[model samples]
Target: MTPLTLQTPEEHPFAQFVRILGKGKRGARALTREEAREAMGMLLDGRVEDTQLGAFLMLLRHKEESPEELAGFTEALRERLRAPALAVDIDWPSYAGKKRHLPWFLLAAKCLAASGLKVFMHGGGAHTAGRLYTEQLLGPLGIPLCRDWAQAEHALANGGLAFMPLGDWAPALQRMIDLRNTLGLRSPIHSLARILNPLGARLGLQSIFHPGYQAVHREASQLLGDTAIVIKGDGGEIEANPDSPCHLYGTAAGLNWDEEWPALAAQRHVKPATLEPEQLLEVWRGEAEDSYGEKAVLATLALALRGLGRAREAAFAEAAALWQGRDRAAL
Candidate 1:
């Protein structure tokens, strides 16, 4: 007979949680991070129902999630999509796309790689659900959506870039993502998936939805003690908050969310610039191929400038100037 993989919600949860809530009537058992990951696996695998899943998810969120809980959530994400090691020397993944107008993620990847920096970009595939996703946007740059770990590693090592589609790499998490409609709010899985460090790479890039998540994500990353660019997405992007030039630095220390942000770094917002998907797509394509000329010049130019404060903005032109040299072009 085959050994059974038990469902997490059906099993034990809240060992760390027990201190506040006290021991349960349901026998002395506790779930580890891996166990929590496994339980999430079950939920994503369709082994659990709507009510049961909601209870488990909300319980953790309402009760105040522990580091262990967060770790378990990431573990499940890793289990579903195993981390791929890269020969390249960068720790992190950048989500693609910009809200109003900037494929700054692509610009960042290209110039950083040219300047001898490595970057891993994950999730370039179309959203199975309604949310606007990044995978499809990088197509303009000929950056293919990596379908598996093998492809991802190869791409990062050779191209200094990688794309991990959620649907393909982490199906269990995908299942949890599907529940967003029924639950009517983001769950632990959504938050966990966003903050995931599958490569153990410290310094990856992230675009977040809520300012409130700053502390939770900051604490988690600080525990890992690796620096990462945690930015509020301009268009749900993992790029900088173009409107505000402040970058949130989170490691295994604490939240830097309170730092004073700057506004002078970004160019004037071309407000009401683009809501048309067609126009947006056209701009993205133009930026990738350098077709928009001066209007879209700074998008890629900002890639080479990565210092703190307004000083970084001044050097943008000089950085963009480097990519024009004949010998510097990347294949």
Candidate 2:
């Protein structure tokens, strides 16, 4: 073998993005909108080394992303998404699995679907334990789960509702989402996924556990030119809790606003013993009397209908009327 000459390798194109955030306090700062867009693009393109990727993600988590950074990162991911064949009326993202209660939001989506709104719901599960995931409840509820864009379209055509797991739409982001188990902390991927809205739906629904992320999502949605509603949902999973007050943020026709909804159930609330999927169906079919669960379903549906452009003045009454008239046979 011939003697080999040693050569200095050029730095990775993605290193500077990490360094920009990790530099000393005097020099380090959040990325501009453009830098964030560029960084996310490089990341999704698989140009960053594993070490650099981890560093960048951790830095973002520690700093909590700015509105600009969120907007840029979301825009980058949105650009890479394979567009669906058809438009959905609502983009419901359920990344935060329910820890304290069952996913009441699943029923909310089904309710919307039954009412003729094509709801496209997406999420991932098993990142954390002792939580109920949206995907797990889809089958029993008779809602179809779409594994790819084609199936998503099929499901929509069949039932007017489709649940797409994040891994199916954005495997790269799913890989990042899985890092939670290794990093022992939540990353910005969680926030970015909620705002993805890959299908460019007319209305987007999101929920956040941390109160501060409400405005981050609101501002980012405005940047994406999406009409959305972000709420402090029950267990942070996009379902209104009849037992507690609800805080909401949203954008309508490009105008941003916030609203406060009082609790529908004022008495003490207790979770069910089984937390089974059947309970959701039971409530929807009018076979079980869960006053709280029913109230939560209607209230959540009302918020969603208003977000989808019903007159705000009559949305709640219309929602209650709709709920009262739902075809039990659909269950």
Candidate 3:
């Protein structure tokens, strides 16, 4: 005689996260900070199954991620980053490529770097079509694209600026971003990447094209004890549109606030029919004049200056001076 025993299969480690999000309308709820950290840890470590990954990402996209979720996810990412300590002044995340205008913010960052501020800028590859990404223009703009942290450190120490592709430091996130076409929609990773601040910079500059995410970023930065500025920037990038009033949502020193910046132009300027990357150089080299582009650069620079504790008027003044004093032959 033998005793019959039955074995039960264990649940997948990642299944719990998916179930939490897709538990039907009433049963579904957001993951708490600890749960979010664990789930994101699995995702970053490639421990999540493909099916689970797809479902989790889509669910977050559908429900939209909460500030707590974003903060938790950022905590997971920061823990996994393979970067050495660097004295970076600004953490500028450039995920959204420009559609309507050249990235005037690129010029702003370069101007700041030339003024001796260490800027760490990172962005994903061109996952979407018809958009000019920052990486694409780095060559023409004479900015160094660091392929590794050593190169990044070198660039920062030598030139005061470094633009690293997302894949270089955070390959898992880059893979998730690459799923845009497969998923047919953006996932929460797009939002999370903006606030990674892997270098632990004093100030972070973020931009979102979609409405309502500004508050998410502001609150998440507050939770992470990060100083950040979020804006509905031009073409979803962090370049302010000089032709329209811009709203800024930010968090610093345990406080959250908002401000409205009036349009620099009295009237709206028509967008260029085509985007020429060389125009960035032209504007920088003092070889050509673009009224719209120049103002956009100044406005974006002012936003960064403001984040660094300058008064509104003082920020704009400092931005103008930085732009004016930039080496014409630098680019």
For each candidate, give its TM-score against the true structure.
Answer: 0.67, 0.94, 0.97
Off by over 4 Å in 3: 1-7
Q: What does candidate 3's lDDT look like per residue over 1-331, in tens digits? A: 8999999999998999999999999999999989999999999999988999999999999999999999999999999988899999999999999989899899999999999999999999898999999989888787899999999999999999999999999999999999999999998899899999999999999998899989988999999999999999998888999999999998899999889999999999888999998888888889999999999999999999999999899999999999999999877
lDDT of 1 by residue, 1-331 (tens): 9999987564334323333223354542445556666676676567665666666766655555555666666656556655556544343344333445545445455655555555656653443354345565557555656778788777777766666767676666666656666777656665666667667653545556566565666666655554545556565555554455545544433434343346444456555454333443343334334233223334323422432222344546555564454132232
lDDT at 68, model 1: 61
What value of lDDT does candidate 1 attain over all alpha carbons?
Answer: 0.53
Q: Per-residue lDDT tens digits of candidate 2, residues 159-204? A: 8899889988888889998999888898899888888888888898
Residue 1 C-alpha lDDT in model 3: 88
Candidate 2 segments exceeding 4 Å error? 1-9
Q: Name the regions of candidate 1 deviating beyond 4 angstroms.
A: 1-50, 60-68, 79-81, 88-99, 124-132, 245-247, 252-261, 265-268, 273-331
Worst 10 residues of 1 by lDDT: 301-310
Question: Candidate 2 at residue 199, lDDT?
Answer: 86
Which candidate has the top score in TM-score?
A: 3
Clashing pairs in 2: none
